[model samples]
Target: MYKYLFFLTASAVPGAALAQDSTEDALAEILAAQDATGPAEQPADNGGEQITIADQLVPSITVTANGLGTDIRNTGQAVTVIDREELVSIQGADPTRALQRVPGVSFSRNGPAGAFTGVNLRGAGSEQVLVLIDGVPVADPSSPAGGFDFGSLLTGTVSKIDVLRGSNSTIWGSDAIGGVIDISTRADTGMQGSLELGSRGTAFASALAGVSEDDFYVGLTGSWYETDGFSSAASGTEEDGFSQIAVGVTAFYDIADSLELSGHLNMSEGLLDIDGFPAPNFTLADTAETQKTLRYWGDIGLTYYGADLTLRARYSRADTDRSNRADTGTLSFESKGQMERADLRGEYRLVGGLSAAFGYDYQRNQYETSFDSFAQANIQGAYVQLGWVLGKLAVHAGGRIDDHDFFGSETSFGGDVSYGLKDDWRLRASFGEGFKAPSLFQLFSDYGNRDLQPELSTSFDLGIEKGQRGTGTHFALSGFRRDSEDLIDFVFCTGLLPSPCSPGQFGTYDNTERARAQGIEAEAGIDVVGTLRISGVYSFVDAEDRMTGLELARRPRHFGTLFADWEAGFGLSLGADLRIVGDSFNDAGNFTQIDGYELLDLRAAMPFGDNLEVFGRVENVFDIEYETVSGYGTAGRGVFAGVRAQM
Candidate 1:
């Protein structure tokens, strides 16, 4: 039997080799055909995707989140696409670190996954950045009322991320006050995967493999990473750091000749150490923490009759435990808590170029603290969006109504209009009403009132895009002004603090007064020679409260990044990126300031074989000293090198 098996394997080797050659030849032919045909010959390119977000079907920059076939240049909206290569190069425990590369995107972290991590765009608050996984919303379950814990997510599970800035409120509602960040896992094309291990106390691995036929395909991916620290401090040292593990799979099946059904599920666990007793920048000597989060989304939908339909549902749960040992030798206590959510929604395109989408969402959250406090909150919302195209013009309109038992009712509306100017150039403008409901902590923290109203804002955006033959560039110059009402104000009330020092003023749900965030955003993607990616984004924002004449804390007046990626022969690639953030206030007190700084990063990958590669990266190449958070400093210089293997 062994002899027969060996003989059969040997005999099949030739066939396998022939198949591989045939596949490569076929791909070459397809690419050649596309180049010959040109985009003008493509149906969808002349249709919506080319005009909505980014080109979603073109192999060059195809993304699923846009629901179209055109490139971002055609979308007429200010949008950016970050692919797998970009995500891997930054090398951070949280995906948020990489977001800094994009214009108008900034984040704040509070102890990893245990507390709040804020993400804001174009002056919108962190909650304004709507988060999506494969077009599904992952509601916050731990909000005493309704606030998201941005760090609860693990980035390794993501295959790619699409960021649409400004008022995407017309296409997405709720947290879309700022914009939208849609993340999708890579689909199984044929069968490909990757694995890697690196230094800086790092161990990383990821795999994306599946089978794709004429009508169906299935893909699976899993990733895990462990790191000690890039810091010398105790909190930033080994044994007191962060670790994460995530896994996901997606399946696409064609039920009918022209109809397709697809779904995906992802889950992750993240751990980070937070020391509370230490000074602002000091590594924690006491009060360590462990946080775990589980999130998954599944959708079953169909496409038929010149239209597309899909339904989605998601569930996420997160829990955190803290062990604190008083430096004064009092006593150590543990605080345990949990958060969870469930959501469902659907979308469809109808006759003509008009499409409609609607869905129902229900969210619930519960948490318990050793301090003898337990709280529960609930919310429900429904939203619908409609889009239409006629001749050289396209329009999209949408609205969402949310009902919160604690905050009452809130409504949001957004719309965008675009028209072809001439010669592959399009002009677009947008307007919308954006809002953020007060967080539970802001409403009832320490000793606060439950009588807080939802925060509201009106936003405006304008831009243009052009696509030509040679030297094509995706360029957009946009500006937005958002006026907030009933803003939450956090003041160091003399009565609430344990000392004379000012208390940390959070927002006031009721006094959510007037604040404005106005900025200019422009990004250009130039196709240089042979798949070279030349991209740059510049943003200048003045985020200040017109009422108080003070700048918003943690926000920069100017920020920018310029980067390029070159694909070399033999699966080798090289990338270099530079990021700059202007000076900004660190606190409302307006006394302390987080100085502006610039940083550079470099990455190189060299293929060792068809399924293995070695890569190296250096972050903060200049060793710039900077801090996004006041008082707390970041790493000076960090290096990471690894070998990746796959089949």
Candidate 2:
């Protein structure tokens, strides 16, 4: 099952390899030669036990940190991993809730679940981040910023999530000026299911089943969720509603002893009741408006393993369609976007501690809207990296060149190094260059600008860590800085043709901004006693426009999370977590202020039988009132309960 995971991710991530049975031993020896931490065994898929702080400290293999499945502490980048157990303990369909606990990460939403949600990493804007699911890039090409919306991503059958902070365009191509978030779904065999009911008429149910043979494996998963949410307007009285259904399939088949084929498909549909300014008032108020969305993405690939070489070829596609209707059921707006990519990648181990990884890829993006007929763009890129290890030191250096339909050619370079020290302490440093091309909506839509250039950035970070996972004490601290230029922003027209703007244009896009983001991130965990564990994460970020020196909108300067879990008697466990966010400006101009807030959550679970467990949680125990976006209503106190069964 783990080998199949490598097959699916290797092509997309660029350095991963499909390992044979003895590959683990070889990898351990390589690590031992470098004097880095040893690889920890993978955890059970869906155990009923609570995820202790020490569980997160365990040094697991991370494919996102580097191109290969390197030990987390052996990589130079700041990385976090949330496994299946932590995801279950978080206990919600929304994964962002758990993501917020990671250092150097924050999020904001217009309202409740199913609303427009955006995530920022290390002070970088949401648009600068790259998101992938099952090795497929799922950002919407029709969006104004070419970014992924986290609102619709539910934790149904997901197994693991990897977050790599800092610029990584050398490995991930484009839109990685900030970082990368990789989501992996279940590919292991067996059966697992969960059912839950919550406040505000909320209900959710999900099921996953798989079968494995001597040479092949196949899995199926499905989920449904619905909720009567509160109004999106802060002072509105009406109640909004949301519902969605998702389904997926994963398969892997072994052809020869060292050859395999793999494929994955996922589809979802959602309907959400949204509140908007209505009629003569035109202020922030409740109105009868709704949105319908259909999204699906998939990929198919083949892999081959040899004596010292591993190769993979794959093709993937993502599509999203959305429509909005008014109170009278009249179509107000509609849009559709599609992204398709094909690539081939290879990994070769030359000697004991020397290796080479290379890949080439082509991507096409197209979008159509009710107002604008259609637009399309294409890009071709190739990259190569060299990894070397010499007693107590390891480094990876890479570069990429890309040709865009409009922008011609651009190149990026990056490298990272990790040095192991005495007593389980490691020092790491990295530097990277990144770029993001203009989105289709920004270049060809009604407000488009043909003269715009791609956004560019340079990032650097340094950190030190002590102890690996499963250890009694573990901590990591890092500082990073990113400088960006040629950022695209909307410019309102002065209504003067041939002078202030294009004719008949109300607004246009232009490269008009320069920005900088610098921050410090710290994380620590400890096993206090035999059955108690504690963990905490904190970040301090200063994000601003270089020209105006004004803080970016909705990005807090200080934010952190604290967690505690205890294993009680009789197969019972209890946990508590607290989240704190400092004040910040609501807009880029620093005109309005959004106050700071804190939330406390409590959870508990116990085994009912051999394969059955019951769990419950209380969110926002104090019913704190706050808004991430101005005038957007947020959820108050809520309680939820669920049951899980696994075999």
Candidate 3:
């Protein structure tokens, strides 16, 4: 299952349309950048019937697996693609809500919207997963774990998300011990916008507009969101408020028939009211604390498309500035993080049914905080993959080598195979090795240690599927296992760390943890009839600490989703989603328990003419009470409604 975040917008490039008939066609159209020479041939249409929302909800093309657009069916790895249609259906102001629908994935939020959020894939730590936004790694180097915050990512600004589950360091490099999340912003040649109002005094608005000429295209997008949220603390009286503003611009120009130049810029600023432990009790409680964040990322690139070869070179950068303030308006904490990267990559179609893809990237990460001085690290990585297809069999093999300024050289390998059988059945298997380097905050902070080694992991999976998405009945069963060593955790100054403990230090980072996770994921969907569809997913994960033989924190053993959708008469659609989660522990020691819960949501959308639509949803229909994290408050029943326009 794939998931993504908030808001809506318009096209930025001539070939950046979200609606494409095929992966190859979409890539060719965007890369060509102009119609002076000719446009890519369109696929043959089947009658005059328009594509259904169901078809658009489950994307079939993947770009994260091989670093290029390819049919998902050909890839043996476990992958999920959530398209714009699905994003819109969820109608969540925060994108993390939609991620719950995916199997083998779970998330915990410290409070309400704009709070600290962490996502786990297949039982991997949040920091072990790599996140890419528009092809740029955007993890905050200033964070202790160097993890991406899902809470900050809103909807509408994102159009599609590709999730590859399992260790994938061979293709994505460090911080991929769990998996990878690739996010793409909306792109289309049109004007579109949406406005929504929901419970808790929540409001959201977004707009996008762009034009495409014969040789050039440019567009602008923006969104604003604010909400007077419920108390973040389980025992609190004051309401916390959150607000954000985001904007983006994209441009492309055709340099020649086979070459193009492109550029993009995006920025988001957010203010969040948080809860903190105050004096007196020094326990989890509400306090007048606020966090302000500003994030910016952009890239400029050149591409060359040949008959049998394609090449791309790009430069990109991501920066994040954050500050926390207390009730007295005094700054409590401040941090800055930056990453600059340059890369060159290409793919060549060799003779027969074999192809090769190779790339090299160099990046520098810098982090600074109020207490900690500026610290920086450099990394250089190179990788290559080979793919071969023969009749009913497809195979992909790849390797990556990364050189970190402090961690030395690390090599990773990954491969997968897919084989077809009769009656539209397929079998797939994959194996991968992954590693994660220590973060700057972990290596240079006041409680840091420089002698920590990188975390290492190995993972494997096998699956069998019947039928394909979009056309009709589709079901898949997969099993996976992952083992991790040298996991870095905070250790008190007990004199057991690899490095000498400094005086007056409360704790230091050390690589002294190991863990294992194994699970089964099953998903099935069927077109019960021409106008109705039903789908369900279930995940069973057994994750535990190797040393203590205890279950990992916040990782549930059972979770699943049951969903149904109906295309009603008069251009109206109705859907229902039921999410179930089992009990879980809140701490590594398994001292506290979190009870299981179930939630149901109902949604409806109706089209008004060809350019407008109205939508609404009833979240937590039963007003279920639960907590993903112990001592935190979860949202109650809420109603939200919105209007959308496109041209």
Candidate 4:
């Protein structure tokens, strides 16, 4: 019978090739670069007819993330999803280059008034990563260093962005250490809308209508953005930066039939212009830093389920008022912050494919920064999670315990496992532990250092996967290792009219008995024909510092990205992208290094008659000159054209 069950399941799986070569070789390079009768596909806007995100593994219902109204493939971890039609087919001007299309995600630009953009996950760093909205915690609790500026947020009513890489610190606790990114809001179904205008002095627009019969639902959004000044010379022509505005609204209802309710509100304003660079004194010139940012957010939620109980509760609010170099009378600064959160979670399924969840969360972080001191801090926490499943095997565990009257208590935990070995083959494993507590501007910020602590982690992973269904193809291969302990370093602060102690003075943000990292990751998704779609990802990181072995400042050892799309039924559509970057070193006074680049992008989509649609794009399409940091040279050979309408 099937060769004795395929040789008794290959002799009871021994070593299973120790995670490497499961054959398929990136699915034979997308079925040998398939063709098999192309064109006839166009479904992608989240609910592409039958749905996608690669079918979310089958199963439904998810509530405000991790509060677990359950069923998102029973939540076993190792998740990656990006919808909203792949987020406007990214060509960047914002939203962190649309998250660099995942896979070892990386981004950094240090300047341009949007002030710093560094989001790294997998290869960690960026304050060990941890960002969530719609589920609370939007980073920056007087953040003196813990990443999460998220490229000045506000993607104008975003839709989806859930990239949970690793070390989840149990169920998301303590900055999750190097993982947890959930940016949600956008489920208007229909009555959707969008508008546009562009190029350096750009004019942009956004809108999504709303209406839902019975069990009420509401939606509304507003956006506007502007940009000017880029004459390259490394963007220094007496530099300039400005323009931005945002407004948002969301609502959901369903009082019974398994009760449901939701709420959200947003506001944003921006005006920035920082043209820095040209320091190291040559009679100082090339300066400009005048910025403003005002933001506000709110949320509320409740959910309940049946067939073994499930529940959730949430409340959140955020406020930010920021100012910098206030027209530079010499040097001036201002920062204001406020965050409030109340979380209550629960889950239960105790039988068969087991499940469990625990709750209780509260946070209050206050801020007041102005360089020479005016700080704040106050944090609180609690968390719990447990899950398991049989039939295709699955398991997950979580924990979060935190306290910070001022950089004190901390706790984190995580676990995961998966197996399906058939119906397309699958196998996975995980181990996680993370922590980071010490902020108030690094314990008193503004050159604060009251003897800091808390920064620990341990991680491990393994993977394998194969695709199924109507052929096409799907693939995954992985490897990772992370080790860190008290490894939070930043020393060398001296002051004497700005000499900040010259020798790691107030620079006491210590913690580094050891630090390490290792990696290898790959991804592939394809459908290749009759609708055409292809995806790719690659990452290789060494990440360093076992005591200044270096490679840790702005880390980068290798990266990758390749994309393709073609939708046709006659209306026509085509898209392409290629990005590869490697080589990096900057930190530890290496004298600067940031070179190793390649970029290409293209797009074409037409439909101008049924609900209007038009497209044109060519970004860096061989713009070849690059630098993501170090003299910051990014943006060359740019062009954009747009039109998208839906009725």
Candidate 5:
């Protein structure tokens, strides 16, 4: 009976292989190699748990740019992984703060917590970067440019974040010109909870519970956060507040020895007070308004792991709704957006050290606005990748072809190579092409232009890295360049002759821009003493519009971060972080300039017993006033404290 059920479930879904292999094997190989030459494991500071050399490097499995599970070192692309432990150490409310420390990444927020936030990778716009929550795309289709807003994300439920830099459209399809950020939630079996209190009437609570056996597991997490924040406008006096609640559940069952089934659900609701720029003068206003947002996402999948082959099939969906209300209790605006996707992927190990991966993807995007009726778009794509690994050299190549309802067809290709020069030294290089189809809002809305072509980009990178496995010393330097053509931009219609004229009205989207971004990134980390560690990252970017030869707005040419941590006796730890950003233009014409600024943060934690711990952090220690976006307010010196329990 169970076998019949399993076959029925498998046959009901579309047949295709989705590459769903876990990186455990790759991680095991690294650990095994380190164990062969490294000393015995050391004791951790908190619970005296054994920590091996591989743990020092934060070894974990990663999906390569070509959609194959592999070790990070085997890939040529620039990548950064932040595990759960690191998130707790940062003491930030969201992943955006931690990502700022990564090389060649920049962030801009419109205001305090819960305000609109954007991330730029290697000088690419936010829309060019794909955001994935549990491997499902989460971009809001109703957004003007169809980008994921970082403000809606909280770290309470996340277990890991993988930031991959550079174009990866060959495998991920569209909207991957900048890179991909994959966020995975906790799946381990146990129970943990936390409570935090901070300045400005802030309160946060989160709990996670899970149980796992040999064949089946289930996990659930929920969190709530509220804060009485300052105004969004820099010069406003009225206070703006924000609150949010989120929940998630994940479950998996092994149908047979070689087959498994998994499902996930996550949702978040938030309300925030926001400020607007009044007309006529177009300056900050003290008036208060309210905005509410709801986000939902889920996925169900099946996987079969054979001796030398793996197949995966999955279906995922994401929906987002946003509404704004005026102080007079009148509905100001509202929008709804949804995305549904189906994927079938498979990977097979062929001859010695050779593997192949193939996948098919189908996606539907729908968006609706109070002013407009409804708009929808569909896309289909297929991809194939090949990887070869030799003694000291590895090579990967892939290509994808996508067919869009409006844009017709587009194709992309990418390749990467890595070679080990010595035991601890490696050299790598990669090149890729990216394409982004026009969003539904850009193609069918009031400002829509159906004639707009897809934006195209080409990117390249080369790097060298050195890692001392046991000594906890690592260093990397990389240089990258990206060229974008036929970029989309909105232009005003002046009702002039020989043009589509709608004088004094909102503009239409058009492909009228070209851009180029080139940069060098350097990072280093070292364990100074038995319980002390230091790390730093630096980025230098030259991002500009090719036609006007002007620097891109909001992207700092020079950005860097430095961090240090010390674990003292008695389960006590102290850490400090410093971030520096260079001056950047606030407008495309470079008329308004935002000044450079430096911020410093401090943190401390101490464990009381085996299951209880207390942690606190001070942000913006010096209270330096700065803004990532003009006319926006930034948080001042704030202190936060929290307690955690695990069972």
Candidate 6:
């Protein structure tokens, strides 16, 4: 299945290898300059001299939430940034665990570790949220929903994660109905390694090595994890195990003072046990089944930075392969998917306090399954954005046009306004449009609908924020609404007298649903003492089908989180957090209701020296019995400890 991509990569390797000598020379020079500058400085502790809350805020150089590299505080969109320090403090094994605390975001997992997990943002399904790694889309085309599996993504090498809420189809072509999650890998010039052991017979290890200089940089990271996890079936006592290995590499070289070339490669492989059903009516059996997945992506790009303008051109390719095997070790299902993309973007400072950005992107997607032959599609998109700042007011607007091989064309537009008030207060509002074309499987498979229209959505939000820069206090309140149209679903044709299905066919896909979601989101944080801090977030969502007036499945109407952290002297810190999920229906008809639950987590860390630290955490402190998915078992109380070293 990967023959084409393998050959393409092989053909390009020689060229990259031929340039290795020059690259090494550049790297050596950069390393020397870095050494001369001395080692990087450690971040300042909050216990030291008091700093303004503004100074303590995350940096403003994010490029994902907005096309322009603007400060998040200045943008009129709801955004969350999780840096490396936060990840370490949370002690989460994967990205999904860390993201659960974010407002307006919820996850439904089938079972324990390595289970199939789905993320729902702002009441939108997993397929409506876009996932990116270093600005490259990573959805699996072979999957029914064409979404990325968050359970497979570990956080060992991640340096930053950005969550941009609401529709962003103007900037991202498709699958941006709910939001976007962009992940950035580490690029620090140092070495870091960690080893961990925990309950459920789990073991994990990771290593990172990187170096940076004045004009060149290179980094590599690798991690391995394995666990004898609990059974996935609700009534099963047999254990289900999982294992995974991942590696990533990144490099950059400056060909000239203003021109630079960069490349990144990421690969992961995993095997997981899944539960199978013996009968149809919601009964989960202990039948053994396993799945193996292999995923990889690589990107190479060149950028030219000038005093008034920046231009970049890049190409990327991603591929995924999956095989499902029965207890007898016979393959039952297999699928392969691949994506290739090329983008050319430019940002220009049109005038004082004003900027413009324009870009063109081309993509090709291909997928194949054991039951069907290969299928492919091509898409081309162009977008333009304008940003203007006048005094304390900022305005941004953008539009995009996408032409798909099968769907014809789609146009999306968005605009935002933000105004600063007195004393660090701000008012903001934004509106955006989103659209998602039918996936390849939905269009060409046996149960496909080639005449289906794209899913469409319009979203709006308004908010106000206040911050006390001097006292480490912050508060934000926001309200959002979204209307989705032409949602696709599979229906049994036998029910209809004049059935559209063939004689033996059971069902076919159709655009037969509409939905609306509205909610309020609130967040607050304050420092009560010198080194103690408390924070909380609450969300209320009313997500339902417009026609049936029934609540959406798996989306809780109310959810919230509260956390406290204390940094005592002697390089020791302790933290605790509580997550609350309200009751939700497990089925579309509002039957089979799932009860609400709350979980408490505790963590502690101690630093032995400047470069080494020991950390431990306890999840589900009360050993509560719960299930995120119907008829599935969840993990009980578990303890984990790990040691980390960096230089």
The lDDT of each candidate is: 0.55, 0.77, 0.77, 0.59, 0.76, 0.74
Q: Write one digit per residue (lDDT tens) for candidate 4, span 303-372.
A: 5544355455667776666666634545466766667777666555565555577766677767776763
Distance from true location, Cα of 9 in model 5, Å: 22
lDDT for model 3, please. 0.77
For model 1, the superposed segments whose C-alpha errors exceed 4 Å read: 1-76, 88-94, 109-117, 143-155, 167-171, 189-199, 211-218, 230-239, 249-265, 278-351, 372-374, 443-448, 468-471, 491-510, 527-533, 567-572
- Residue-wise C-alpha lDDT for candidate 3, range 191-216, written one tens digit per residue: 99999999999999988887766566
Better of 3 and 6 by lDDT: 3
**lDDT tens digits, residue span 370-426, model 1:** 443666656677777676665666666778788877878887777667777767677
Residue-level lDDT tens digits of model 5 in 344-450: 88776677667787889899999999987799999999988887777667788889999999889999999998787865788989999998888888898877877
Cα deviation in Å at residue 401, candidate 1?
2.5
TM per prediction:
0.76, 0.91, 0.91, 0.30, 0.90, 0.90
Which regions of candidate 2 fall more than 4 Å away from where they truly are?
A: 1-59, 469-471, 493-503
Candidate 5, residue 615: the lDDT equals 97
**Is candidate 4 or 5 superior in lDDT?**
5
Q: Candidate 4 has what TM-score?
A: 0.30
* Per-residue error (Å), model 1, residue 128: 2.9
Cα misplacement distance, residue 190 of candidate 3 (Å) = 1.2
* Model 5 residue-pair collision total: 5
* Tens digit per residue, CA lDDT, model 2, 1-647: 12323322211110000000011111211222122344222223433332222232222656666555576765788888887788887888888878977899988887777878888998888888887777677777877788777776778666677888998888788898898887776654589889999999999888888786766767888888889999989999888887888888777777876676777777888888888888698887888888888877788877775556767777888888888899889999888888899887767777777778777889999999898889899998998888777666788899999999988898999999988888878999999988999999888988888777889999999999888532479889999999999998998877434543467888898788999999899988899998788989999999999989999999999999998888877888898889999999999899999999999999999997889999999999999999889999999999999999999
